[model samples]
Target chain A: MMTATRTKNTTTVELEGDRVVVIARTFRAPPRHVFDAWTKPELVARWWAPKSHGVTVKSIDADVEIGGRYRYVLSHGDNEFAFSGEYVEIDRPGRLVYTQVFEAFPDQPTTITVTFEEEDGLTRMVSREVYASAEARTAALESGMESGMRETMDQLDELVAELAAG
Target chain B: MVETFAALAEPNRFRIVELLRSGPRPVNTIGERLALRQPQVSKHLKVLKAAGLVEVEPRAQQRFYALRPEPLRRLDDWLDRYRQLWDERFDAMDEVLEELTQKEDEG
Candidate 1:
């Protein structure tokens, strides 16, 4: 088990044998802005990628449909990271389920489920990822998932404020 | 991500990625640039093809290999869980900077 603190949130990542669960929450922005910042490609690019990396989207095609496909890329300096997937379910402005394939390993794919809820105008988004194997999931969590997320959520808080103010 | 990473793990595979970084190119051209034997390059390409990291376009008898970005999108989706973390941290930093600037203004 490992614990990390963001600007105003506490995150705990625990490895239960091989299954890893990461839970974090921040208190400072409205849920709508957070959700919008997530769903919008432009807003996403601003705060996407790790703190030391810049993400350049080669293309973005999202319809927000149940069977729609979303594809994009992220570059960390000179290295390019590719990913794409089809939406299994979409309850817009609320929840989403999709399969993500990492360009690095085409044979391995993971499923991501996200939910957004409003509390006093602040949005709480929770994401759960299930991998094909326990070892694979552990590899992901150990591979900078905590530090990467700490930086991303921090940027997200700012993006929400900026979009709202704009 | 395994296939893409595995493809990138090899020196030759990394060469291919570096080439595509500028833009897509023909496999023959890529082979020439890397000085790799045509058969060897084709074999490496076979692995990449199975990974969906590279796409092939046929023009008559010749084929062109282009970096298709769909797989990267899949990686990004998985990485999206961290998007909020960076946003929150940067947002706080901005607040600290703003407060400092405001104090300077008051002074």
Candidate 2:
């Protein structure tokens, strides 16, 4: 049994099988608008690189079509990290399947499949990421750890709760 | 922390850790519950101990094995960071969606 942790009020993350991670959340908006916010570069900039995490959007280029590519860069002070990917499938307002490669580990790419379901004008967004292997999935998840984030557990707990709550 | 992950990656060891979660128990008890041989249980416990995941305590004639929470807590913290990274973006996306909808309503 995989132990999945829910963020109290926000995202619920599950480690599915051996090489997949499923993250899900619901938003109070229609699916088409939610899909637009993800595909449109300008709106992606408004959300992708969160300022609260000390990261700012450097640039974003999302070509929202089959065979098209997208790249996003986020900078934290003097350091910048980039993730680029190609679209594998597209079903507007319902589904998007893309292959993503973080520049840090360009050799191993993860395929991300996102689905949007609308009920009562609320969109439930679920992202399923399939990695090369179980070890690769763990490595990708541990990338933040490698970046030298050493916040005390109490501080982390508080920050996580705040993010999940607000 | 990476060592902790590697140690728990093995299915038998993972099951041992799960069994230990309820409370401390002797090696024989663990073997019986998990249906593994006593020697195999000892081997897994040694690896877990080296990884600082399990600790043994001598209680009179029997020894009790229990989880060492520190390493597990750190692992939990790491997973939280991964979750937080995406949650932050999703929360921001919520705002972006709101603005987009509001603009459409206005126009």
Candidate 3:
């Protein structure tokens, strides 16, 4: 069983199988409002970019329906990054499915599904990202492997020892 | 990096890496444990060695193959970036939702 790492605001992130990342979070807003925040381009532009990174959302084009497409461009100083996706499924205030591809790295595209469930007055949202492969997921990072290597090596050793003994 | 991914992508080679994680093992021992032929095991080891994911050490007449930590470490660090990216995005989304809820309550 995979363990989910929980963060503030009750957000949980877990690796599903080898190539899927599942993230779940509960918001105080209703399901409709929460769903709208994702489907509306203006709302997405307001919150999608990581604030501390100094990345600004340059433009957003969203058509929130089945077979519709969405595109977003972000800029960090002189460098511009673009990502686009096509909707596969759309169930208002409930579910959404899309294929997402980063323009810079078009080789591996990921499929993402978002589901919203209403509990009491709060909205529970779950997003699942399925990568083409484990290699594709790792390749997305592109650089830096200095820290955390020793700890991972130690864990691998322990896991191997346990497997061998069992 | 592409070489490492290509080398490790093979099922047999990946299993060998996992097996070597316990400790170094001679070619014949790895073959026996994995039910693979000696030649097959050697082929996989050659690929792994070429990719720098494994190294061989000669002791007397035998050569023991052990997993190299560097490539695996690089893979782990690469995956960490995706994890961090999602975390940051979700955090920002939470802030947005909170602000929107506040606006709705006021109006």
lDDT of 2 by residue, A1-166 (tens): 2267534338877666567778888887899998898888988888876566566788999888999999887666666667888999999999999988766567777888999999787888898888876777776667544433555443332332222111
Question: Compared with the true structure, what per-residue lDDT tens digits does model 2 show for residues B2-98?
Answer: 5787788788999999999999999999999999999999999999999999999999999999999999888788777677777778888877876
User: Evaluated with DockQ, which candidate comes out highest?
Assistant: 2
Candidate 2 segments exceeding 4 Å error: A1-9, A16-19, A76-80, A133-139, A143-166, B104-107
Using all chains and alpha carbons, the TM-scores for the candidates as numbered come to 0.48, 0.77, 0.68
Which residue pairs in candidate 3 collide?
none
Give the RMSD in angstroms, all C-alphas superposed, for model 1.
18.1
Residues B1-107, candidate 1: write the lDDT tens digits.
65654565577876786787677677778889999988888898888888898888887777888787886665555445444444544464334434434555599
List model 1 lDDT by residue over A40-159, tens digit each: 665555544434433344544565578887765654445555667778987766777877766556565777777778777555666666565654663453343444345464443322
Q: List chain A TM-scores, every candidate, in order.
A: 0.70, 0.81, 0.79
Model 3, A74-163: lDDT tens digits are 765666667887999999899988888777566667888999999998899998888787765444434212222333433322222111
- What 10-residue stretch in candidate 1 chain B is worst by lDDT? B92-101
Question: What TM-score number comes out for model 2?
Answer: 0.77
DockQ (Cα-based) for each candidate: 0.03, 0.42, 0.22
lDDT of candidate 3 at residue A79, scale 0 to 100: 62
CAPRI category for model 2: acceptable
